[model samples]
Structures are given as structure tokens and as C-alpha cells.
Target: MDTRRLTQYVICVCVILTTVTLAQGQIKRCFACRSRGALGDCKDPFRFNSTHLVPGVKDEPCASGWCSKRIEGKKDGKDHDLAIERQCLQRSPPDDKERCSEALVGHRKIFICFCYGDLCNSASGIKPSFLLLFIPLAFQMLSSRF
Candidate 1:
């Protein structure tokens, strides 16, 4: 092949390879989504919360397919639980605690200090607002003793 033609061919091949790599990188998924037939009841209301469908896939790119729950899984006036976050979706029924626990499983990938309900205790470090709320009560107790 001529030098000019060979250079063009090389450029075209590089472009194709870059495009494929970029496309694959765009398909990342959340760490919580579980396998269920077509989102099942594992979804959230779009108007109130941002949702990630097919959440727990390992290297899938995140995509926006959110809708305002055009349908309901109501059973006797109660909404159906969508297993959109973690294995809670695959649960049989009436296992609310399991769902909650899974939801709070924390990013094990994050530091252990931040994993799951670490903020539940006083030792987690108090917010100034919360300490402010107790100031009045402390003052009242001191005044009563006086």
C-alpha cells in the first residue's frame, strides 16, 4: 500500500477502537441492583427520589430510565415493594427487616468508619445543631437545682 493510504487506514482503526472503549465505559451500574424480571417491584417513585435501575450489576454503566411510577403494585391499598436496591427485591414476601438491612449494608468499599449505621451513636461525632437542642434542657436542670 502507498504511505498515504496506510496512514489513513491506521487512523480509522484507532478511531474505531476508541469509540468502542468509550461506549463500554459508559455502561457502569450501581452496586445494589439485583436480578429480577423487568424491574419487578424493585423501583422507586421518581418524583420523590432519584432511582438507579438494575442497580447491582458489576461493571454496567448507569443509565437514566426513571419514570414517575406510572403503575402501582397496590395490594389492598398498600404499595408493592420494589426490590430495586440489592437482593431485597428477590425476597418472597413479608420480610421487611431483610429489605431494610440490605439497604443499609453500607459501601464496604468505603472506609469502615463510614460503613452502615456508624452515625447512630453519640460517639460518631455530634452535629452542632443537635448539641444546641440540648442546651436549653441542661440549663433548665441547672436552674431547678439552684
Candidate 2:
């Protein structure tokens, strides 16, 4: 390739990469439920009463973390205790499972766990968030080369 064409190609690749990186750093989604009725009512297969789109923290990437908290306790004295509260946390530890879990603990009779990924704590299953992003990114990368 000629010098000018090569420079253009490099610039194009850089732009594409930058765009993808920025996009990946934003737009995280998590299931949210704060109401007692929603927690008990949205059952069978389990459904989130709603979802939370996390906002970007100052000096941090927007929506880069997904967090869910399930508060488990016993209504009566039985082993069948269930999660009484479930919510999507606004700010969460990023990419650190241990830290997330640790942060969720310290409540009596309440079992809490945190995970990274959209709807990861749902009864259905975890949704593959990266696949959606990568499909378009791969296409862009492939298309740009030609």
C-alpha cells in the first residue's frame, strides 16, 4: 500500500478500536427488584421486577460493572429460607468476584452474592453480554480490512 493509503488504513483501524473500547466500557445492565411483592410475585421461572442501567461514576467508565444482591433469610425457623430482597446495585466492584462477594456480606441471616454480567443472578441464567458486542465488532474489523 502507498504511504497515504497505509496511514488512512491505520487511522481507520484506530478509530474502530477506540470506538469499540469506549462502547464496551459503557452500557451495563442488571436485574433489579426492591419490592416485597415483586420478589414473591415474580416467581416460577423468576423474573426481575425491573432493570437498572448503571450510570458512569466520576473518573470511571460508565456501566462497566453489573451487580445483583439477594438477601436470604428465614421467615420461620426452617431450612426453606428464601431471598427476601433482591436488587441491582448502582455501584459495584469491577471484575473482582471476591471483592464483590466480600462487599455483599456482613448482614445477619442474609446471604448475599454478587456477579458480573447482565442478568447473571436471574433464575433463568446469565445472559452473554460480550457476544452481542463482539459480533458487531468482529464484523466491523473484518469489513474495515477490505
Candidate 3:
């Protein structure tokens, strides 16, 4: 191949490789579960379970997933609750908690915390500290490239 053609081919290959790597990296696969029935129902509203969906296998797509829910109520003369509804959501809820109101599920006071990232809805629930750390790194990468 001529010099110009050869240079173009190398650039194309690099671009393809980088695109594939970045695409794979962005697919935030998280532990999939729900607090319904026998799924991930929190029997103890104050505690969180660490049950993940297959340790190393990224089974589900979590592009915009979050996992934070707590529901408490009384049943059968005992206090029943569901702590962390650890799972993945296809898209985020439409309203923020401030604007999002609560509802009564048969005397259960359900509290939901919406956040973003892989398994980020855990106890921490999308920490600003992480965003603070991520912003500078992203800025440096983009600025350095320019």
C-alpha cells in the first residue's frame, strides 16, 4: 500500500479497537434482583444483603441501573421489612426523591433512593465523593488529548 493508504489503515484499526474497548467498558452490568415475593425481598429493612448475580459474570445490562430500597411493616405479630432491594433497573425512575412522593403498600412505609452506576445503590447510594474523583480524571483525559 502507498504511504497515505497505509497510515489510514492503521488509524482505522486503532479507532476500531478503541471503540470496542470503550463500549465494553461502559456496559455497567450489576447484580440483578428485586424486592418482590421470594426474589430479593428485604425481610429486615435495616440490613443489606450482598447477594450478587454470579461473581465474575456480567449477566445483565445496567447502563443506568440503581439498587436502593427499604420497606418496613408489621405482619404475623412481627416486624417485617425489606432492606436493600439490590437489583438493576433498565432506566432510572422518572422523578427525584425530593419530588417523588411515597405511597402506602398496606401499611408499609416504603422509601426509595434513586442513584446511578453499577451496584451504586448499595448502602453508599451514589456518593458525591466518587463524582468528585471522576470529574477531574475525565477532564484531565479530555484536556490532555486536546
Q: Pick the candidate with the highest lDDT.
A: 2
Query: Could you tell me the lDDT of residue 52 within candidate 3?
Result: 40
Summarize candidate 3's per-residue lDDT along 1-146 as a digit string, tens digits: 76566556655655666576566557665544444432343333323323443332223557665444443443435333433344566666766332223567676676555555555544543334333455455445445544
Model 1 residue 132 CA deviation (Å) reads 54
Task: Give per-model TM-scores.
Answer: 0.26, 0.44, 0.41
Error of 2 at 104 (Å): 9.5
- Per-candidate Cα lDDT values, in order, are 0.31, 0.50, 0.48
Estimate the TM-score for candidate 1: 0.26
Can you rank all candidates by TM-score, best first?
A: 2, 3, 1
Candidate 3 collision pairs: 42-81, 42-82
What lDDT is obtained when candidate 3 is compared to the true structure? 0.48
Q: What are the per-model numbers of colliding residue pairs?
A: 14, 0, 2
Please report, as a residue range, the 10-residue window in candidate 3 with the lowest summed lDDT: 41-50
Instruction: Tell me the spans in candidate 3 whose CA falls farther than 4 Å from its real position.
Output: 1-25, 33-60, 74-83, 96-102, 125-146
What's model 3's TM-score?
Answer: 0.41
CA error at residue 82 for candidate 3, angstroms: 4.6
Any idea what lDDT model 1 has?
0.31
